[model samples]
Target: MIKRLCFWLRADRLGPDIPITHLMLYFPALMRMICSKRFNGFGEGSEFRPGAYADNCSSITIGKNVAVRPGTMLFAEKGDGVPGRIIIEDDVLLGPGIHFYCPNHSYKDASRPIPEQGYFYKGDIVVRRGAWIGAKSVILSGVEIGEHAVVGAGSIVTKSVEPFTVVAGNPARLIKRLR
Candidate 1:
């Protein structure tokens, strides 16, 4: 009941979409209250900037001191009585326009449209402690971003990144290894 009320309050002002929906996050107190009430776990000192949104918040867990900038979206799928999960560890830095997708569409049937084929839950997405995700980066399902690793802006991560490494570009190839 409380969750529904919070959703209604957010939906009334945010309209259940990205970009515009993120505007409500500008109010720190309101955003904190809403997130605390909605998500499965929301740690202290985490900031959700304006223009950020999360789907299925109850399945998501956010750690302390994580900063999610504006225009970022975190989506977790709940399918077949199983809930998808996303875990953002402590001290993570997320830039603007970043997107995390914890589910993908099934396209096994050639004749049917992708959307009509239903969806697949790929598993949880874990952003390790102190990792930095650049602006506009897309982190796909089942991908674990290693601790202290850096994902370049506009990159598309399809696999788990190595710890203390820098990756960039589509498919997110490793660029440099940090000490």
Candidate 2:
């Protein structure tokens, strides 16, 4: 009953296709409450800044003290009736314009257009505890960003990053390994 009411209120206030859903970024308590009700698992003190977009909130799990900056997009691909999961562990810091894609499209058939080929589920994306993903970084499917790892700004993470390491550049090469 309350869930339906909240949904109706949101739909009425924000309309159907607003780019930014939650408007109260400055109000942490309200934001936390709203996100906790929507997401799969939203831990305490986790905040989603204004303009953060989640394609399917039910597939995204946010941990405690995680800060997702504005313009971050969390997209969980739905395949075989199961949506891809994005698990962001505790104390992670996500910069603006960060993108996490849990599934990729199949383009094996050259004859068909890329869009026509359709998509496939790669796997869940896990950002381990204390990891920091920099601004505009793109994290591809089936990648596990290890604990305390730092992904540099504008990097494209194609593979699993090692724990306590710093990665940068296109394809995200390991720049340094922290203690």
lDDT of candidate 1 vs native?
Answer: 0.81
lDDT by candidate, in order shown: 0.81, 0.81
Cα lDDT, model 2, residue 147: 96
* lDDT tens per residue, model 2, 1-179: 77776564453122124433555555777677667766888888788777777766777899999877777888876453458888999999898999988868788999999888778866889999999999999999899999999999999999999999999999999999998
TM-score of 1: 0.85
Per TM-score, the best of the predicted structures is 2
For residue 164, give model 1's deviation from the true position in Å. 0.7
- Model 1: which ten-residue window has the lowest total lDDT? 12-21
Name model 2 segments beyond 4 Å from true: 1-22, 79-81
